[model samples]
Target: FGLTRDIYETDYYRRGGRSFLPIRWMAPESLRDGRFDTLSDVWSFGVLLWEIATLAEQPYQGYGNEEVVHYVRYGNITLERPPNCPEILHKLMRACWTFSPGDRISFRSIVDELVPYENEDFRLNAYYHTQPHSQQETVLTDSNSDEKDLLLVDDNASEQQ
Candidate 1:
């Protein structure tokens, strides 16, 4: 996740000139720098909007990662959502890919905007954990200290869950 220009220059991009970034899933700030926030990730997800609509065809096809880097640096390759894409989605994608990081929309806003499509069961599936409490406790306590403490506590707990 901590992608940097130095790494990009030395690694994948040098081999094929295009790194197959799957930019749809990558945070844009990753294309620029590592100090990005969630908004940058949302921007990547917005790009995913187009990819999903097109069944994962490359974003900005005909360019590799290096070419994309150059084009992005020069402000040349503005992404256009596929012609058949919906206007609401197109606008959403635009907000996600804005050059200025501050201008990108928040994930909360995106979810709010998409709320109309959600069903009652959809809300419940996410809001409530289905596993019984006893099962959860059993799983949490079953791991040995070595396995449980392999990494930092904060992240490990989440991983175990």
Candidate 2:
């Protein structure tokens, strides 16, 4: 695969030492109990989507690390959907952020949901139909809006093999 993540581990906390954690991208449960499980990865992926949607803007822009933990873990706050993000991706991100781990969408299901969007038809539906191959980029433009979006993908996807 062009860029794949391999995940295989259980949640843990060392008994008598300090540990580094990704504070902003953590799930509520992870922040609460130091439990970083697969479901936590889903939550982090949602934040990653938010980062991409914001063109790398930091999540909870006005909040400090402790504030993020308090708001997300106790206040049940989540980042609002970016104004320019496509509905489909935003829906996926929301699913990934479900508070209950059991309710969070699985990675396999995320792949299944996104698989259909790989086709030209879905791009058209999303108003991202242009397919200029030179830079390996697909551009999304809306006639009524000034914003433009770019998506880069490999011509030879590993899934094709």
Candidate 3:
């Protein structure tokens, strides 16, 4: 649940293999004893996709590291997208979660799915830009020191989680 470099070398599913902590936002392969390509990264992104679709709650909030590990290993969590989330996006999210390493969907396919969504997002954005709201939206652009503090805070918060 927190950021740790320690390898989760025991497979929670009894799959008779070593496990590893998902490195930050990367996949299991990032901590494995080999090269981790973009595919593995996609797998990790799938978890983030779940988080975003669920209104920013963590992928498995309130769970300890061991429980999160078990949940991912055994496919226990059924990620439910928010009501307004499109089905195509949900399918793409599921595609990223395909278990077999070789069977996972390609990044190109992901882009194909995302292109339409991005276009829709763009249209919505353009519409919003044309309208006048009561107050101007404020964006906090982080400075280098702010970024460092953010990382530190994230590290601390993750530990607490």
lDDT of 2 by residue, 1-161 (tens): 73554231112223346664567788888888889888999999999999999998778877666677778887468999998899999999999999888999999999899988697767666544565544363444556666654455665564467
Q: Each model's TM-score, in the order given?
A: 0.60, 0.62, 0.51
Ranked candidates, highest lDDT first: 2, 1, 3
Clashes of each: 1, 0, 2
Displacement of residue 68 (Cα, Å) in model 3 is 1.5
Q: List the residue pairs that clash in candidate 3.
A: 8-19, 9-19
Off by over 4 Å in 3: 1-35, 74-78, 117-161
Model 3 lDDT per residue over 33-99, tens place: 4447878778777878776787766455566556655555555654567667878878877888776
User: Best by TM-score, which number?
Assistant: 2
lDDT of each: 0.65, 0.77, 0.60
Q: Please write out the lDDT profile of model 1 over residues 1-161, one tens digit for every residue.
A: 66644543322343347544444344546666645578778877887888887776667777676777766655567676687888888888887777777777889989788788778788668634454543342223436575564332343456667
- For model 1, the stretches where C-alpha displacement exceeds 4 angstroms are 1-28, 119-161
